[model samples]
Target: MSTQYTFEAIGTHWQIDIKDAITKEQSGELYEQIIKRIALFDAHYSRFRADSLVSTIARAPGSYQLPDDAEPMLSLYHKLYRMTDGRFTPLIGQALSDAGYDAHYSLKEKKLSPPPPWDEALIYNYPTLITQLPVLLDVGAAGKGYLIDIVGELLEHAGIRNYTVDAGGDMRHRTTAHMPLRVGLENPADTTQVIGIVDLQNQSLCGSAGNRRQWGNFHHILDPRSLTSPTHIAALWAVADTTLLADALSTCLFFVPPETLLKHYAFEYLILQSDFTVIMSPHFPARLFTVK
Candidate 1:
């Protein structure tokens, strides 16, 4: 039987089908519109870019008001700041720049060495308002997911329920009774290949491996506590209800040990040890586990 295909948006690979309720021409047009919508939302919501409104707030020091869209994210960011006891912080911009990674990515392809991890240099927090200076917000991990959430909302409002939004390596899946979605886990030692697989149904997944996009022996996953590259685990796979949580969890949980993860999160986990041993949460769906 021929399989059904769902339209995709926001630079994510489209898992579309020639067979759908809408005609081929209509689907193509809708996809194009979605892409344009993605760009519009990105320019407005980005906090890292100097052109964004949040960046304007970051540049200005005292008592700055924000748009409604930015208020929720900025508010939640502060909450995360308190939750991890400063472990998962967005105020490491200066530290990241001083240590290297000043650019969007390493302009010099194949860098000789990875720069050091960033520290939250300074913060100003009150009941409602919070501010930070000298720290650049590299929300690369979560910002895209945030975009996914926004775009997903727009798509849903447009009466398109069966679709997916993937930004970079992060993806959010929302589909009808199509075949189950499958995502592969990359080995931190050699990320070119899939080390494992996970089943997906109306879910979101993000991978943070110390192997791919490396800086010599150093990888992108940095430890906030140690102020250096992560050493404990090879890669991490996190699944959650929201892409925001999935993205942040993938980024923050990578720094701490598995024991710390077990202590805090009640959701499923798939962690790869430095020695290649796998640690999975008790609730992980058995059908998804790949035998390697």
Candidate 2:
């Protein structure tokens, strides 16, 4: 029998399932440790928290030394920043805040502001992040995936070989079980309906929908170039070896094409267009239900 636990963190619900038989006491202890780790991440990375490291850096000017643990996230961000040609940027925090997804988490519509110029505003040297201008650094897109990877490492360190860590729609699973896990894809038009399901094993999946968070004509995913929400695609999902890659790629799918993206990275993807047409990569291992 599998053991399961659920808790709230990172402004979303997280669930952990252990496929092996485990004591309730064991499960409780593991859950506590996971929650504690998540809290630490939030304290450091969450833009919503005024005391967060990201918030502090955003408030300050000049160079700031990043924590030792920030290397993985920063390195990935730097690579993505270069690969997407400024489409995927952590420097969009001001733009996001101006659109009302600020530190308070309230959704008050405001005049949209352009994101900081990537070339002039931000600079990074692994453990050090230098900001020439006052800019809010938002890593929400890839940060959650990195957090999931960290938790998965924690589970591995604990000798738990078969488990699944699910944070909202992003999931990472590793199991000795013969059957692959089935994950549902939500329809952008109707949240209640599952458009399709993906069979996953020992992999990570991240899903992003433009309609997930919206106010007026603006949504969470913004095009840095146009200073507006992308209208071409409604939703996208990517499966990768790690949650971090999957999470970042899900957002990247909006701005970059699969052919262009595959040149630098390897992942399977499925995208739902604004016209309700579903497109999938050749190797996308999922059964997509057509919209009739």
Candidate 3:
């Protein structure tokens, strides 16, 4: 029998099937490493997680010098700043916190209903590692994906030749079966109903649009370009070779118009629309999936 290792890692439980040569204790040790890595990533990078180092710095003023580990992600934050044309600004944390997501998912009493005002973002200096205003930063959009990347890298480095690391369903996967990973795409509107499934082998797959930021069918995939929610499209999933690409791309693609997205990203796609139609990228990995 193919041995299946099942447990929680990176905030999501997993079931990994391997050839019988891999022992249960070996799998258990691997899982232990995975959790340690998750804790490490959170301590260094997460903005929503209060116990993290970043949050500690954010809570402190008078210019706190960042540790060596935070320096790399600080570099990524800069890169993401440039790449997204300021749409993916880490300063959105202030906006998110103003909405009452402090310490947890719970928002402030007035946080839920209203929209943020335009042009309120603080000008952050990346190279200088300083902020001009009191910005409440939320890494909710990117931190989890970063965690997945780190875990996947660990699995790759440990000679776990074929493995998958999923952080709350955001996956960095590599599989061997002449096919991709058999993954179910959870509907943002109804978490139980998988809108579709995809195969992810030697690729990273992330679900961020449509069903994710939702109430009923309407959701929060707001386009920073237009500063409005996208219409008609029900869901969007992106597959790429890197977690950062998958994470950042998902935010924009889920929020903006299709034509606008085409101009922005050259990646492949599988977008589900309102009329029960599927619009896929020219080279989307449809060959990997079994439509059931």
Candidate 4:
């Protein structure tokens, strides 16, 4: 028996499953803790929130201390920023806001300029971030995945062994029984149907696309350099040992070729083109349905 908890937080929905049954009292305690932890994360990172640490950074250029848990996420961002030739950047926050995906959900586009270079915009040294200029930092690409991993760690710390932490479809699953979780890959063009299915066990899977959070001529994923969204790919997904890598790669694949990232990471991927053609790693571990 499993107990699943569902709630909305950090601009998305979260569903966590405890594969092993627990007493009602235990479940209640765990749920409370989860809610509190997610709230803390939002308070620190949510760009949409005026009270968030991200907002504080946007207000002025100064050296600010980060939470103890910020090292992993910031480290990954730094690596990805370098690996993707500045395409995948936290500095894209201002451009995204200009495109109208702001706190107001205005969905109105304004003039946009390329974000500043990563090195010039800020300096990230674990537990401390120094902003050289007033800039908006958006970590939407991998923040959710990192948070999922955080929640997963929380469960493990509490002695829960079999569980899954899913936030807005990006998830991390672990099971002592070695049972695989079958997940469907949703079709961006046709959300009512799935393009394929993947059997995930002891791994994390993340997908990204322009279908959601879209505006007149832009989606959430915008190129920091070109200041435009890629029209070639419709959707993409990645599976890796950690949700952070999977989430970051799903976004990175939009800008760089697989071979470019393959040199740095170990993972499987599937990319669906706008014209309906598919590109996937040979060992992607997913069965796709025919697209007509």
Candidate 5:
């Protein structure tokens, strides 16, 4: 038996499923708690929200205190920023806006410039993040995944051992029965069809592609240095112990090679090229329809 809760939040859809049955009252309480937590995160991180902390930072350069749980996300950004040579950066928020992905979803193209280097843009030190310049910070790459992890933790703390917390398509799954959850990998070019399938167990899987959000030859994933999205890759996915890592790496793979990240992180990945060429780790637990 399973209980499912679905809602839209943080500019995306969220679905949480508990494999074990619980009282209606318990479900209601958990749903409330999850909603509140997601709201708190969006209030601080969403650049689309005019009243968000990100907008405040964009308005001025100064030291700002973030939520107590902001450290993990910030720290991950800092690390990936350095690893990708400034390609994968939170500083790309303004660049995204300049390319027409602004707060209004205008989708209008404009003159664009690359984001400033991380060191030149801001300094992240745990609970405090100091902005060297008034820059719009976007964490669309991994913020949702981190939140999924948080919600998963919330469920675990409630003594629920078998559940899945999925935001959009990125998700975290845990099952004590050891029964794997079979997930279909959506084909980027054709949403109606899946190119592959994976049996996700006590792990997280995240995927990224340019087709999801596009405007004037640009998608959500932008190269900080070139100020353009990579056209070579069609889609990519990563599986890891934590959704945060899986989510971040899925975006990172677009800018860097799997080997470049594999040296530092323990994860399995699959990259589908524009020409349908597949590059994947041997250990990736998935079967692709395109692979004969």
Candidate 6:
């Protein structure tokens, strides 16, 4: 028999579904472990929490040493920062807060502040992060995906192979089953409608929409260069071998076109433009719905 558990963390709902012959007690134990693991990630990485490591670093000046757990994400951000030509940056945390997404999670629209120059904003020496200017570091772009992967690793360590870790729109699955999982792509204009479906197995899929979290004229996804929400793409979805890559790529695809991103990354994507037209990568493995 299969079992499913749901919990809230990092400002989003997390669902873990295990397709296995597990008992109620075993499932309960697994759920508790998952919750603890997610909580650890929140404590270290969540910018919404004032006591979080990321928040402490953002509020302080000069150099700070990150914990061992943050090394992977920091390295990933550095690589993405260069690859996307500053399109994806952790230094946009202050810009996001100025845009009204602050430590309290308030949604009210606020004044837009231009982000510091990418070249002179900060310095990263692996485990040590040094800031030359006043900058807030936000890793919300890929942090959730990284946490999802961590949860998946926990499951694997516990001998759970056929399971799915879904954090809101970010998802990761590993299964030996014969049936392919069906993932619905929601239309940004209408939440109830599915614009496309992806048949996935042993893969990760992450979707981001500019309309999901909006306040006044502001959306969650902001361009560091303009300090404003992007108007070109309404939503995007990416499938990759790792949830971290998929999550980062989904946001990166918003600023950088799929054609340009494809040269550097190996992933399939689907994008819905602000004009309501849908476009998919040449190798997008999803079947689009004709009527949407």
List clashing residue pairs in candidate 1.
Answer: 5-17, 93-136
Off by over 4 Å in 1: 1-20, 23-29, 44-48, 104-134, 257-266, 286-292
In Å, residue 9's CA in model 4 sits off its true spot by: 1.0
Candidate 6, residues 230-270: lDDT per residue as tens digits? 88998899999999999989888878877777777789888
User: What tens digits encode model 1's per-residue C-alpha lDDT throughout 75-169?
Assistant: 55555555556666666544444444554654233322222222233343332233443334555556666766766676667566666666656
Residue pairs clashing, model 2: none
TM-score of each: 0.75, 0.95, 0.75, 0.98, 0.98, 0.94
Which segments of model 6 are wrong by more than 4 Å?
Answer: none
- Count clashing pairs, candidate 5: 0
For each candidate, the alpha-carbon lDDT, in order, equals 0.58, 0.86, 0.60, 0.92, 0.91, 0.84
Error of 4 at 165 (Å): 1.3
Q: What is the Å distance of residue 3 in model 1 from its true position?
A: 12
Candidates in descending lDDT order: 4, 5, 2, 6, 3, 1
| Model 6, TM vs. native | 0.94
Q: Is candidate 2 or candidate 3 better by TM-score?
A: 2
Please state the error at residue 239 of candidate 1 in Å: 0.8
lDDT, residue 288, candidate 1: 38
Error of 2 at 24 (Å): 3.2
lDDT of 5 by residue, 21-135 (tens): 8999999999999999998999989999999998988998999998887888889888888788888888888889989999899999889988887888777786888998889
- Residue-level lDDT of model 2, residues 63-95, one tens digit each, is 888876788887887788888888898988888
